[model samples]
Target: MASWVILVGRISDVDHSATPHKIITNRDYLAHPALFRGQRPNVINLSNNYGYQSRGYYASLLASSRGHRVIPTVETMIDLSERKLYENALPELEQALNRCRKELGGEIPSRLTVFFGIAPSKASDRFARLLFDWFRAPALEVAIRDEKGWASIRKIGFLPLARMSEAEKERFVACLGTYTSREWRDSRTRTQARYSFATLVDPNEELPPSAISSLRHWARVAEKMGVEVEPITKKDLARLANYDALFIRETTAISNHTYRFARRAQQEGMPVIDDPLSMIRCTNKVYLNELMTLNKVPVPPTVMIAGPADLEIAAQTLGFPLVLKIPDSSFSRGVKKASSPAELKALATQWLADSDLLIAQKFLPTEYDWRIGVLGGEPLFSVHYLMAKKHWQIVNHERGGKPVEGGFKSFTLAGTPQHVIDVAVRAARCIGDGLYGVDLKETAEGVYVIEVNDNPNLDHGCEDAGEKDVVWQRLTQWFIDRLERQGR
Candidate 1:
């Protein structure tokens, strides 16, 4: 797929001669890029007049929500639209100054802030030359009324003055006066970040180097990409400010420091992996089930065993030989298969001791489950994870399970079944366009999503076994693209 522009309205009217790029009109298909669709990430720049009536607003919003890069982003369009509707001019000239001051945080006396929501289209004309004699200086206590003495409330409609003549500059300055207000941000507190990247790794909880040489391999990749990567331990919570972006490599829990790091990094305007929203949505099976079901993503025959009474309902709905899961368990832990009523009761009682709910799913016995590693809504690598020998699950974490091992066979995206690819991508998009490992089961019934895991395993030897180099490159490049787009 080539670079596409979403020219929603009047594609014929749009003169695309200025840039040599493919334009997707209302008639063209907006493709969710396939794995074979080359290197460039799918992008859409919305080129349409945005207002309440224009389809551009909805298009921009949807594109942005799905993590597409949109020009004149949804927020910008709304800001401009609101300017035409909800604006108050403070007596006269460049009336948006007050809003800028507000955006900068209340009032600032020392530092001046100006905003250009929509840049001046045309040039400032001779109308700007006329200025009152009293407005020549920063008049702090002038009347709210203009020189005419009538009530003054002028709209902000100015043109760019980057190439103004000396005479025009003087007149322009005289037309606008400054005012004194309290400082919005302190000068001393604002400092440039010291490092380019900070990987949030818990010494005890990070993926093992055997499964993933992340510390050394990713650091090397970062180096090759000209990114300065540093390991930030749990103790470096305050030092989050020192880095431009964060990558949490630890097991994230909503109640733990990992989630806090993700939240804080997002708040500080850094591109983060396992983004806070993803962490919140993917951490709980209950949330994933509802989200997927609501969105029509194929999920297994499942029921929420929320209370003691629901156990019978689950038994009736799913019948015998079903799986029970605690909402937020990892590494095949807290997941149990109950073949009988007694086993189901025992497992439910054990899991319910912690979480308020349990996820009871009909056991879909298969040789191997499909694990699709989707990043940015496209498959990076996929694997068929086989059950352990003589075990019911890929990983047996039971008290005396056979030496804790899981088998996997990697495959290129093209070699995988289309249903697997389609369902995985569909399931992933329902969750955000972040790095996700969508685990799914392919059965005689249909392809059913097991669960969507955020911060999916990027084990160097396993997940990356197919397109070894591409897997690592894709992950690192995602950060690079995010940082560059953010202008970090």
Candidate 2:
């Protein structure tokens, strides 16, 4: 649970009777220390002016320095004040504006006010959400214009509460109540959990890293450990500042919203599982292959293919029956087996259209691939992912569009082979000391590393079968240890 406070330049700017939150003036907030000395509450700075050295600016600036999560951060205030500073965000905002324009029959109002990511009209609510994601503020005014047939963002700036009309003030109060309610999960009414944990999950994800049941199980377990666990989605990006730590349960990719969440959490100074750096390192196969080889981790002989011109060279290096993979591929979707020279040429040519670089590794025929779940640079659980029925890969995607995955056999850490555990930990360390599942192949020769995945599957019955409570306990402790180290 997180404490919250609303700061305004003038006490009369807002009707305190309309809201339950404590509203303080900028004078008291800046001069008084007893109000929020040690308690770092989520501060909502709705000051009237944000000019250089203004009280509004100082309120937010001081709140940040006091280790409090304040919206309309100094950086955001500065960025919104200058066009060049916020130009990088215009492309995405313009794209969102065009989408909203289409939703309104290719026409929309030239001006709109967004209060806590909620538009006055329901038609533009999505655009409001995107705007809030980019610029976190209490109120924002977006000016849209027609350029030919498309919509463009002409100017965007902060909207203070004092400028709102009576009806708009009522609506703004409702919006403020809605926004603060999401962040203010008081411990008195809730459980006695000392820390709030957010598990990022998507129920609509086709193949999520952790099942909803698994997330529920972890939440129940975490509650017993004095940690209030909440399942949040991608839409809860702005609310991330309220949680003490974040655990991503969705499959992570550098180009997706998962990376954005991770990066945002890192920026908020929160401990996040599968941090942005780990996602960047593990999402791309070419990078992983090079990193493993450079770290002296045992991996199959692999070659990189730039285009059709380099296909022959890759073939000569790895030979036939090689594994072909796009740079950013997961779940065996972009992975294929090139059994012959002609098939290699066809697959390489087709895959080259999507990515400039491809990875070709010697295909090691193994009955099962060993998956060692490593956390905090230590091996936690091990499983043998068997090959699909008469299929070369663990997941068979060629049979229609649906995927058929093979069975998994879980093993206690002590029951697993030491060599396998050693290789998995070493490979995972090459990436970072975060949660990971390292896939390896064992043969008569030796164990070879395949891939190090960032968000490993911790399904209810699959990964937790061997070490049920121990798994949850250690994971909870991981966050606790890091948070305590940071004096959270």
Candidate 3:
């Protein structure tokens, strides 16, 4: 875990002085990184140094550059701090201004929202936007501009302060008050953090190996690197804000709890995996095919099956041994290999009922399909999933439609063919830098992208086999790097 350092110009706050953290003078904080040690500590700026003009500003800029998580991040300071604080509550301020304008007979100059670092020489102070979130404004300042270029300022009287719950008040107070609460400490770090992993587990369903031994291994490796790891469940949504970052271990879907968690975590400014957009883009094959074809990525000859007539066009265009798949199908669940018109009709008729459209592809048979795991825009690992015995797909699920995966072979990143890696990166790039699995088929003619999936499996021994614990460590490392970019 990262350490804590309190920065103050004076030790006047007795409650703050009691913390065991190392203390540094505000002047020393403004000094460059070369003057300090290398560890990145979490800092509390008690000097109340704020704004672009303050020494505390330079200190924060320097601290963040050195990887420290300084409170009142430059972003928070610029976007939500003093002087500009009232502007942060633009909606309420605008409403107050409009009300003043209406009271003054529709004159635009009748009202305004203003801020000053010092006590105002005119008008009056009526509202305060607290440093912590949850905004409110009760009144406004009226600016009366006459034919002369000069203007006179008078108060329009702010609205009554918005009533806040006990929790909101306490949260606001604790955030700006003396002692940092244990809960806040758990969720955010003044320094580097031992992050949280959001995952789902169900006994009735089969999960990848990463859920077990790989998960345990992640914790072990995290500890070795001075990082913390915790596995959380879907029920922990309310508690998610207490963690440093979110890594979704469950399969992601745009409409599911996983998407909700990612969206919420993102709103709170925490780094997240399988970000909401990635889930939406990667989960739907229709979207993926369109994206790939538009970006000029090589894909099997494909057509959309939106109407009954298109099925005939597909048959004529793609011919026998073609494949038909539902847009959101996974694990070979809604995929079918059609060898005849009757089979295509039965499958397309049944599948089209569930989705508005389907995909038809030229079937490209191979001994196995390559699964390239790409992370942070680079290829991390590769696996070859051999087709199941007497089955056309890697996962044989035709019997009762239950998925049955087959044997897999993992290879080091360096050992995989360059063309495979290059094409994999190209496909993954169509999506963002989020973790992805690019499935491809390597044939004598060339390589063709099968699909790009977010939240690709990181099975303990399989995906990580290429580099041992390095794969998991690299994953956690990305989280750590991204977490540093968030919050103060």
Candidate 4:
């Protein structure tokens, strides 16, 4: 069997068009000229654009120089025009690869990898489908880097025959059998399966149907790709050692079960999707603000308030018409805007009564915010979120009433501003590597970090209705690829 290693580009590193050339040169030096005596090694380059200017061509040139074979997996254009029909092409991609392996004397290359080169110009429905197909193979190694420079070795699926000892294989197979049995039973019931997956939130907590819908969509996608996804509750977290991976559905804090699961999963050597360290670092507004500032990333002025008095002082200093938020909430929950001293005082008082900490910052009256999804540290997709009508928050519920409709409008990835991309990457680096959503605001001054969500919702019908399916598809593929690497 042939041995393989996968490398993904750091999305943040390639803001200029010339960055791809830099990456190609680095790969060539590391794997060919320096390590392999100018001999080419098998490489797979994954990217959205298929144009001649794309990274595929860059990979081909590098491979040819090293006298090695390079496989260019050009991802199809993801846009409103092609979003809904992407999944239909998965089987074709898989079949093509299987055929290639068969023709290569039945010896599949030991390393299959993916790179999230850059954010797409548009969100594609088929993008997710393509990712799921790529990850379905148990023999793939996955690495991801986001638009920011943060990079991580996300997962290694099945061990290559050349790398695994007989004892290691036996132990892995035993663990697999246990996980498979649980998956089999969980798949039979929605409730049971959901509770069996992983604990991001308390299973007993009454999640909004919107949240449940998102979870179901992810579970369905995982099933379609031959992975069993079930919800694991806080009470059952100790059993994490039995699984190959853990999937989290929302942002969480250091005190939450989701973080606990991540810590445990990492210790056990299981690939924890979304990752615990990522959650702890991203969920805290204060931490994100400080990190961004330290890294010279543009961020709005922010103050952390520990009590009502502290909030009042901060409010007076920051001025009215500011944004106030809890340290660990997503989907615009526990976030509010204060327009006057009286309003700020009252809101601060109430918030302090309910939470231990709050963040007060100058509100950038930008009409829209950007939600950039960084998977395995790579910016997979981005969408512009317009504030809800008659509401200041993007996904806020009414005052003691149900959520209002038409509060958000999503634009294609191409529509996002360059500043949004710059600020997003800067913010993501502060949060470390994993899967995350970098929320940003473009003010007159510049782009600022509004919040960094560790578990940004991947709801099927949320902000970007057109790209919801694709988001899940890419996410599923990420998990699948990670698992393959871990097993390897």
C-alpha RMSD between model 2 and the true structure = 17.4
Candidate 1 clashing pairs, residues 3+ apart or interchain:
107-182, 108-182
Q: Write the per-residue lDDT of candidate 1 for residues 160-208, one digit (tens) a residue.
A: 2333445544443333211111111111112234348888776665333
Can you list the residue pairs that collide in candidate 3?
42-190, 42-191, 70-488, 138-158, 138-159, 139-158, 139-159, 187-242, 194-228
lDDT by residue for model 3 (1-488), tens: 45667666555422444455677766666533444455767776644445443555445545654556666444344333333223323444444334444444545454443321111222222222221222211112234443333233333222111333444333333433333332233222223234565444332346442465567778888878767777777778777778777777777665456766776666566777877657756777766776687567899999878668888899999999899988776777678899999999999988876665689999999989999999999988899988987888988877666567789999998999999999999999878888898999999889999999887878778888887888878888888778666533
Model 2 residue 467 lDDT score: 77
Q: Give per-residue CA lDDT, model 4, range 94-192, as digits (tens).
A: 444344433445443333332221111122213222443333221223332222222222333322323445654444334323322332111010011
RMSD per model, one decimal? 16.2, 17.4, 19.5, 19.9
Instruction: Give candidate 2 misplaced runs (Cα > 4 Å).
Output: 1-194
lDDT of 4: 0.52
Question: Which residue pairs show backbone clashes in model 2?
Answer: none
Write candidate 2's Cα lDDT for 1-488 as tens digits: 67778898889888889888789998678655356766879999989987644567656755654567888776567667766546656887888878877668778778889998899988788889888887788899888888788888889999888777788889899998888878532211111123698889889888898889888898889888999999999989867888888999988875567877776677567788988768756877766776676568999998877668878887898888899998677888899999999999999989877664678999899999999999999987888999999999999999997789999999888889999999999999888888999999999999999999998888877887787779888999999998887766
Give the TM-scores of the predictions, in the order they appear: 0.60, 0.63, 0.61, 0.52
Per-residue lDDT value at 135 in model 3: 23
Better of 2 and 3 by TM-score: 2
